[model samples]
Target: MSRDRTRTRERSGDAGEEFDAEFELDSELDPDADEDRTRADPDDASGGFRSRAAERAGALFAPRIFIAALLVTVGALFATSTFIPLPGAGLAGVFAAAFLFGAVLKDRRYAETVLSGALAAGGSAVLDFAVVALFGGVGLPLVAVAGGLGAVVAAVGTYFGRDLRKGLTQDL
Candidate 1:
């Protein structure tokens, strides 16, 4: 059995020979493919243009600054609700809060944006749920469904905003 195994190993090693595979390169290339290789004009300061929203979406994130911005936004929301007495403020505040949170804390990464948006929207939904339960206006089912939708909106909005930041960074 040992001799047979050794013979099999030797046969396999002999069979496993290296071969250099070669292929002919294409001597003729499409002219259209080469056209895209042209460099931008030296005089043009901007190498290429991306949307403004994409540019600002790339802003740096500092933990301290993010926390401060969030606190300010929360305070503003409370003040706006108490002193301003604006209708539809609750929904607006939620969206605005998430947007502000994302604007301050979100990095260019989509995952981070999504996470921030989800947290903001989730917080807003919880608050909305509590208000509804206390006030006894909107039903529980409606609140639940709307909360889910709001969360989705917040995440999508944050992602787009962050994506726009990339272009903004390039401009600066």
Candidate 2:
């Protein structure tokens, strides 16, 4: 067999012998090397899927003015239902006022307005139950029925109120 020769370097450590190996540098890291490498566009944020997802997630928690308004309206409704029972006649006006207020001054989203109105109605119902429990002899079943009716009425009225506002705006 013909003699073969190849230069190599090795070091003997306490554990074992280690050989040195050569590694090639990437073209991008080698400044002196001429090569074409694609770079991302600085203004192209739309290319990232997470960017759009993050924006949508942020929109869900946007501040709403109607939440405080709902609580105040609920308290007022409770007082009315407690001291002045008018065969549910006052409920219509209260719900209508709340809906108009939300439609005109608060967030215009349909779901938000309807939910606020529903919550206000529920709060009024709870207050009615509390008053009855403390002072009156009405049964729990009756209180639940009344509360459910109030919630339904409020939700329906609020939906119509928002629709009316949208219609008026479209007409003008």
Candidate 3:
């Protein structure tokens, strides 16, 4: 079977005049058509590699997820420092924030979730370093260690959160 689709395009210029352009597209409805193609082959030369790379990058470090994780981690750390005032309060806050974020995350991909947690931890570590630097001189090594530890802690927390989410959603 064949179908005709009509599309209208409206154009306006600086002269304030408007015109409408109409076009008809003829398409054939074929049962054998490849309609289920989801991803482009990476080896293809016609921009497929770029698109595939972009898709992988987007999946790994989505901007929205990264920003949300960073904000949540920072907020939790600030709240913990202000209210708890414990020795390891920042780490505890990061873990809790990451756990809650992971549990609420809609994406079920493991790599993305873990990477988001790590990035968030690293960002919070930098922020903490900046704040501490204002008080007195601090060593870069300390920041590095804090970032590494935060990454590990956040990763563990996110893992447990994901497990909790899976357990809750699964059918008995």
Candidate 4:
């Protein structure tokens, strides 16, 4: 049995030198032992089942920051609508809001900024629909378009904002 378990091979350059390697058959080891060791305790209070990505995402979308961003965006939109009587003013407000939000955050991750911007826009769209629904109905597809446009504007705004931050922090 030992001889069958052992493998022998000759070295290519060595003169009659042999190497032996031993391997264990599957039947010799208990597969359930590994499963038992790796399985997590169902009664454990610690969050051992959560993945790293989920943890990072949760950290990125902290409630305080997210709510602040949304409020800022909505306020900017309303202020722009009230003060500026021009086309695309709401979008400009969204861009500015996203830019400011990105600039204010200490963390360098842009995903949070972009997500906030998109959600803000989506929220605004819902509000718009709520108001318009009183008079007439609007299509739901428009809200999705607004969200996508918000994401793009947010990405651009975040890029410029981060660039400004970098420039300010750099040595002259």
lDDT (C-alpha, whole model) for all candidates: 0.47, 0.56, 0.67, 0.68
The TM-scores of all predictions, comma-separated, are 0.37, 0.46, 0.65, 0.60
Summing lDDT over every window of 10 consecutive residues in candidate 4, give the lowest-scoring window.
1-10
- Model 1 poorest ten-residue lDDT run: 1-10
Report the lDDT of model 3 for residue 61: 72
Greater TM-score among 1 and 4 belongs to: 4
- Which number leads on TM-score? 3
* Candidate 2 Cα errors over 4 Å, as ranges: 1-63, 75-84, 87-90, 105-108, 131-147
Candidate 3 local lDDT, 10-118, one digit each (tens): 6676767777776434324554332222233334445656766898898777877766777877777768867986655777887887788778886754454455445
lDDT of 2 by residue, 1-172 (tens): 2223345677877758788765444544555332222224445545444665776655543335446546645665666666777756546645765666646753444444445555665555556467765567665565556556655666666667667777777855
- Candidate 2 is scored at a TM of 0.46
lDDT tens digits, residue span 1-172, model 4: 2222545565757576766666545334665543343355565324445654577777766776767767877788778866897744676787888788767766764676577668767666677666663455554665677788777887788788777887888899
Report residue 81 deviation for candidate 3 (angstroms). Answer: 1.3
What's the lDDT for residue 95 in model 1?
Answer: 50
Per-candidate clashes come to: 12, 0, 0, 0
Residue ranges of candidate 3 with Cα displaced over 4 Å: 1-44, 108-138
> Where in model 4 is the C-alpha error above 4 Å?
1-55, 126-138
